[model samples]
Target chain A: DAGVTQSPTHLIKTRGQHVTLRCSPISGHKSVSWYQQVLGQGPQFIFQYYEKEERGRGNFPDRFSARQFPNYSSELNVNALLLGDSALYLCASSLAGGRRNEQFFGPGTRLTVL
Target chain B: GESVGLHLPTLSVQEGDNSIINCAYSNSASDYFIWYKQESGKGPQFIIDIRSNMDKRQGQRVTVLLNKTVKHLSLQIAATQPGDSAVYFCAETWSNDYKLSFGAGTTVTVRA
Candidate 1:
């Protein structure tokens, strides 16, 4: 079966613009999480959704938000993007929420903010 | 304000040799620890994981050792290959929490 999949592999936006990245979880998976990976750094958690409910959030600003659909797909939105927002946005999926569940990640969408 | 961190920023290992990467976490409440490998322009791939109840776990050619006393974690790659050249990260999390606190990552370069 295919792993997690993301759309718009690459995106370019201005400092004040908004961008949305999409992710489709693996079949049978019910949890999805978003992470932002800066160059030369490990991924930082942004948001996690399980069963279409917000389960957790990271230290990111209010400009970042995410929502999951009934099909286990998720969308990450960033508003009023800043140059610091330029990074790879990764989406991970697991069988369910909580511990002991292995998460599979997507290729990620590269967001470049100017 | 605890976080996971790596001992080294980079490592160079010769082919066929074993490689060891180390990480330290400050959160004693963290019960689940995971290792991930990430290549350029790609997302991280789960390598292995261990719970606080266990000290060691092994996968195909990879071993993860956790020492809760010192809050240290290590990943050992047997017979390192060129394909293993990438950045490795250690993440810590609680059993009930959904966020994964990740380390800075160690870059592994397999020499020819």
Candidate 2:
């Protein structure tokens, strides 16, 4: 089976602009989560959606939001982007939303804010 | 306020030698731990995982040792090879929590 997949592997946006990144989870997976990885740093959790409901959220600002579809795909949106927002946006999927499941990650979308 | 952290920023070893990476976590409540390997321009790949109930778990060529008492975690690579060069991160999570707190990561370089 294919692993988690992401779209628009690379994106360039300007300050104050908005950008959307997409992710398609592995087949039979139910939970999807988003994380932001800055260069030279580990990934920071952003949002987690299970059964299309928000299950967990990280310390990110209100400018960041995400939603999951019925098919378990997800979209991460950043509004009024800042230079600090430039990083790799990663998506991970698990069989469920709890600690019992192991998450599989995608290649991630590289967002460059100019 | 709980977090995970690594002891060293980088480690260099000969291709035939063994590699050991260490991590410390502040959360005593954390029961699940995982180790990930990330290469340049790629997402983290799962290496191995161990739960608080267990002290050690071994994979193909990797071993994860968890010390719940010391709140420490370590990953050991046997007969390290060039393909093992990458950044390794340790993550912790509790039973009820869906989020994982990751450490800064340790970069390993294998010299042939």
Candidate 3:
């Protein structure tokens, strides 16, 4: 079975620019979540979408947003990016939402903001 | 275990030796815990999970122990190998919010 897949493995952008990262969830998986991992840090949750609807959100600012499609693929959008946003953007998919959710993660897209 | 240095904590262990990495959680209400291993430029891979109901869970050569009385968690690997080298993170999940709060992570380097 194919694992979670993310697109645009790497990207570079300047401050105040916009970037969108894409993710395709595994087959038969309906829940998708986004996380940001800086160097030497753990993955920080951003947004979680289930059945094309957002189920939960983390402590990120308003500049970060995401949506899930009917096909279970998702996209993460960052507006007016900052250098601090330079990190590995990871996409994870689980069988369902709610408690005790075990997620399978993608390789992650490395985002560089200059 | 774990330390609060600017960099991730590093634990070097020789191959064929046993390894133990520890984590202290802040919340007492956390009922579920999970350990993940992340390699170079890769996302975390789930190692094992244990609930508060039990003090330990074993999978293959890996074992996870939880001490609710002290809010401590540890991962023990028997006969450690070079492939076990990675950043290990412990996460806690509460019943209220399904979000998993991750630790800073401990780097385990299995020396040959």
Candidate 4:
């Protein structure tokens, strides 16, 4: 089966602009999560949705938000982007939304804010 | 302010040799730990995971050892190959949490 997939592999935005990234979870998966990875750093959790409900959120600013669809796909939106927002936005999926479940990740969408 | 962290920033291992990467976590409540491998321009791939109840777990040619007493974790790869070259990260989360906290990764380079 195909793994988690993300869209718009690359995106460029200006400061104060808004951007949206998309992700589709693996078939039969019910949980989707978003993470941001700065260059040379590990990924930082942003948001997690399970069964189409908000289950968890990270320490990111209010400018970052996410929602999951009935089909288990997800969209991550960033508003008023800043240069610090430039990084790879990753999406992961798992059979469940628990910490014990292993998460499979997507190739990620590279976002650059000028 | 406690978070997961790695002991070494990089490691170079000869082909066919064993490789070891270490990580330290400060959250005493963390019960689940996972190791991930990430290549250039790619997302992290889960390698293996071990619960606080277990001290060691093995999968394929990899072994994860956890020492709760010191809050230390290690990943060992047997007969390392070039394909194993990548940045390895250790993440932790407690039973009640839904997000995984990751550490600064250790870059592993396999020398031929």
Top of the candidates by lDDT: 4
Give the per-residue lDDT of model 2 (tens digit) for B1-112. 1112458989988888888899998799999999999998788999999989999999999889999888999999988999999999999999778898999999998988
lDDT of 3 by residue, A1-114 (tens): 899999899999999999999999889999998999998788888988889988889999999999998898999999999999999999999989764778998999999999
**DockQ of the candidate models in sequence:** 0.74, 0.72, 0.69, 0.80
Interface RMSD computed for candidate 4 is what?
A: 0.7
lDDT of each: 0.91, 0.91, 0.89, 0.93
Candidate 1 per-residue lDDT over residues B6-74, each given as its tens digit = 588999898998888999987999999999999987889999999999999999999899999999999
Per-residue lDDT for B47 in model 4? Answer: 97
- Candidate 2 chain A minimal-lDDT segment of 10 residues: A96-105
In the range B1-112, model 4's lDDT, one tens digit per residue, is 1112458889988899888899998799999999999998888999999999999999999999999999999998998999999999999999788999999999988889
The superposed Cα distance between candidate 2 and the true structure at residue A77, in angstroms, equals 0.5
Q: Kindly list the per-residue Cα lDDT of model 3 for residues B4-104, writing each as its tens digit.
A: 32323888888898888889888999999999999997888999999999999999998898989989998888899999999999989888875778899
Query: Per-candidate TM vs. native?
Result: 0.95, 0.95, 0.95, 0.96
Arranged by DockQ, best first: 4, 1, 2, 3
- Model 1 clash pairs are none
Model 3 segments beyond 4 Å from truth? B1-8
Worst 10 residues of 4 chain A by lDDT: A94-103
lDDT of 4 by residue, A1-114 (tens): 899999999999999999999999999999999999999888999999999999999999999999999999999999999999999999999998877778999999999999
lDDT of 2 by residue, A1-114 (tens): 899999999999999999999999999999999999999888999999999999999999999999999999999999999999999999999999875688999999999999
Better of 1 and 3 by lDDT: 1
Report the error of model 2 at residue B60, Å.
1.1
